[model samples]
Target: MSAPDVFAPARLGPVTLRNRTVKAATFEGRTPEGLVTDGLIDYHLAVARGGIGLTTVAYLSVAPEGRTHREVIVVGEHSLGGLTRLTDAIHETGAAVAAQVGHAGPVANGRSNGVKAIAASSMPSPLSMQMVKAATEADLTRVTKAYVAAARTLVRAGFDVLELHMAHSYLISSFLAPGLNRRKDGWAGSLENRARLGRQVARAVRDEVGDEVAVTAKVSLSDGFKGGVTTADGLAFAQLLEQDGTVDALQMSGGSSLMNPMYLFRGGAPVKEFAASMPLPVRLGMRTPVGRSFMKTYPFEEAYFRDKALQFRAGLSLPLMLLGGINRRDTMEQAMADGFDFVAMGRAVLREPDLVNRLQSERVESGVCIHCNRCMPTIYSGTRCPIIDLELAAHRDPLPQI
Candidate 1:
């Protein structure tokens, strides 16, 4: 068969998307006081109105310390009304909405959270400048329950889907990382032990939500570093997740936010913009010999992860969503032709939320996002395209500043 049209509807587990387009979860620093803000809702609503099939609300932390910033959506009681409003607004725009849930673990902003960071093993944390504690069996149990609770909260909030953030060196990915997880017991050693935490959390989420909601997971296809979870292990883990019945769909992603941070986005973070946006301590840390070496950059390329993701498509039977560096009509067509179920856009959609509607035309080439990765640092200020903001300002004034 020929490549399916990009704008076609897609069914994801219990939910049905209006189109194959998914606005991938990009952290919008819109939450404040641990509650959803109108800005957060408006952000997703704009994407939904822009004609996305499903717009994901990003980084709803399972617990407080899981957040990379002090201000983020914490899965809790008072959030019910705001999230309900968010879902309603998106639904009104004729789009489905999903919530991306995760725990940041060692990558968390413990200083801002006023707690020591926890990880899969006790390790020297350059960021916190202290040894991060390894989670105990009790801690593991607690975190697993947190996932269950987050799923319930999402269901109550009227979210049609819950995308678990298991990739990017978070709580789950930390354990999966062999370099980070060196435990000798149940939580480490072999791949099976290392993958236990993710499996447990996924099972708990399924038990909690049952068929009432669709659950998807974003998993690292590779950590892009030595002694880390390799591409081979990532495929094994993906197979295990399917065997455990933990996901309705699997989204492929790579890189460690702590290790090969630049590997996630090949173009790399704009260091100058990142430093300018950081607090004094983080700013200074980035200049440190260690930090400077850690924040590496890579060249920009379209469909950056396609090569590895194709390897995944070859092995797994579960539906997969292709992410990373998809910015053009032809790229989406390639994904369809490759037998991928969905295509997710982060910077592409951020640059042009209406890019989906515009993609129907063969004349549309790609999004206006240059992929400079300048927006990486804006996590502290609300993640957005600086270019788009400048464009909006120019449109409002209709004049140049002298």
Candidate 2:
């Protein structure tokens, strides 16, 4: 099956996308002082103009304390001007814009604003393995308020969509992951309890934003970690969200922070290395980067995971946004044919901002993303996007005439 309407416009709640191609969130470390800069504006505008249906701003923290890094954009009253400017720029190209709102949880080093990080439990991060302070009831209240406030701000700033970042072992994800969230409290014991905060945040945001803005969540179907949130848990959560009508769409993803970096962003860890490192119990279905080359070479009858996600959504009637490793037109078309309403592209959009336009015109050549994961490392470096050659060139030789 091929894409149903690859080049056609489709409605997503209130907004319409020019094409099915969405430029997924990729951090461009251009923000300074938690504010958007000219470079950031130029970067997104380039992609928007390139003909993608939508482009999401990466890692916009709902609260100062929730920030992933110092360079991440802060969605607060003070950030309205810059965010509005960004939305207007993207709108100029007829592309919709979504803001990814999240708190980094244990991943938050408080390096951005010097605030202490909070989490569902006091478990240490796998990367740093440093114990994070557990979130008190008051802290949870503040976190919920922050998400509502940020959603309101995004609406005011003219964003067309609000995507709750509930995946990749962030605060919401940590709450969902049983392995990390060992709290005996009401917000931690059962699956229903673990989903409470996310539900509250979504409800608050919806109330504030009203029915005008599209609300969605990027959710991990499984943590891919020992004793973590499983696919069954994810499905139950999805059902709850559907029953409450809290979210308009669900972006299915997998893996956890310490366990599966590749699941957060496609083509990160080499497939073989990731699979080999996994515990034997979960190694049966594992496929790594080394295996990807071979998988592409061999003629396989089975559909990929992206295709299988459609099966997962069988009972639910909500629109689904399929992501992860969707690079080529044929694969995207296959997703659409399989009943997926939308498709998202991350690294490919980063390497070639105009990929959508090239695909639409049947002129797309090889994508620029080398799958090196160099871009991911840049988030911690205070700037994102290592592939911006023009920026690198300018740094190498400043304007001599000036």
Candidate 3:
């Protein structure tokens, strides 16, 4: 079988990707005490050597308070040794590396970190159901500096790309959502106000990294919650980032922390009816029902957003990367045919580290990802893929319960 256009070379800002396939930022439980472990480095190297154009390191926290948990890799100036080694291993496999920088905000595990979780307002997360303290002006400033410091560290570590994680109910996404951010201050209320922090973070990163590194944003097209950030708002924010001249590319995703488990992991629901039977109230104003129904009929191998991703792309002039359930050559080709510049895969790489190489050499008929979402639940338990039998072959011991 011939490889599709997705395997073709493309430009992601200043860096040139060998193919459109990007290993989306998926957390591995290997980072211990904010330092990269040999297991993490080897995991990424496997994906890189497997033939991915780029591999993203997950949850590289800009600040200790922003950390989702203590196990996540810290990208501050103090934690460069492990990061540099990780990047070197990926580069050795001939794959470009991108770091996903984020702040967990109110979603940060307060019980795990023993620190007050902060957000745009004092709203509680539906998932964790914990109340977050409203961020003070000083807190916001400190977080912004943390992001800049992290980006500078990534550049120093020789990473080719930096992705600001502004989606999935993180600090930035929480601030952007009207339902989450009810503050009357300058950082809240209106769309422009909600986007202020993200814009500032992008600018600060650009200032720190300059033209040498590519800067991109992973933005939620819809929060999948009532009165939250909408596609219209996302389009506006993408324009804002573009106008600021700091963002090099845009990756579009949907759903907030409260809604759509399938948002990040496409095809996780065993039966299509299960996805259809999900409470529509949870999806509310977003066009999730329509998109979900379409996914049911099509069942593409790539990310779930491949079909509707162009809707967000059409609204922006910059390069757009589609993420979700992408896992096959045909689906990837379709994504390119529809104008997506990149296809981002998460669980596919988790299940089969050499998926890219196998696909390129026609050694595998299809990706090994079963889409069970067992990997997602493991994030809380210790963030490695539980279903990846071979990857866990060495660790036959029982995992500690979360």
Which candidate tops TM-score? 1
Q: What C-alpha lDDT values do all the predictions have?
A: 0.85, 0.74, 0.77
Off by over 4 Å in 3: 1-4, 125-130, 258-260, 269-303, 380-385, 390-402
Alpha carbon RMSD to native, model 2: 7.0
Estimate, for each residue in 1-402, the C-alpha lDDT of model 2 and write its tens digit.
454787799888777778777777766767867888888889888889888898998889987767765667778878899999999989988999999998988767553356767789986433232356899999889988989888888899999999998877789888988887889889988889999988888888888887889999988777666666788888888888888888888888776654455545544444454445333422432333322321111121212356447655785788888877666777777778778888887777777778888877778634556665556555444334566755677779565795
Going through the candidates in the order shown, the clash numbers are: 0, 7, 10
lDDT of 1: 0.85
Best by lDDT: 1
| Ranking of all predicted structures according to lDDT, beginning with the best and ending with the worst | 1, 3, 2
TM-score, per-candidate, Cα-based: 0.95, 0.84, 0.85
| lDDT tens per residue, model 1, 1-402 | 787777888789988788888999888988868787888888897788878898998888888878876787788887878899889988999999999998988888677777777889887655655567898898888889998988998899999999998888888989999888988888898889899999999999988998887899999988887867788889999999999987999989988877777888878568787778777766666666656766687898998899999999999999999999999888998999999999999988888888888886554777778988878888767888888777788889556768
Between candidates 1 and 3, name the one with more favorable lDDT.
Answer: 1
lDDT of 2 at 164: 93
Count of clashing pairs, candidate 3 = 10
Q: TM-score-based ranking, best first?
A: 1, 3, 2
The lDDT of model 3 is 0.77
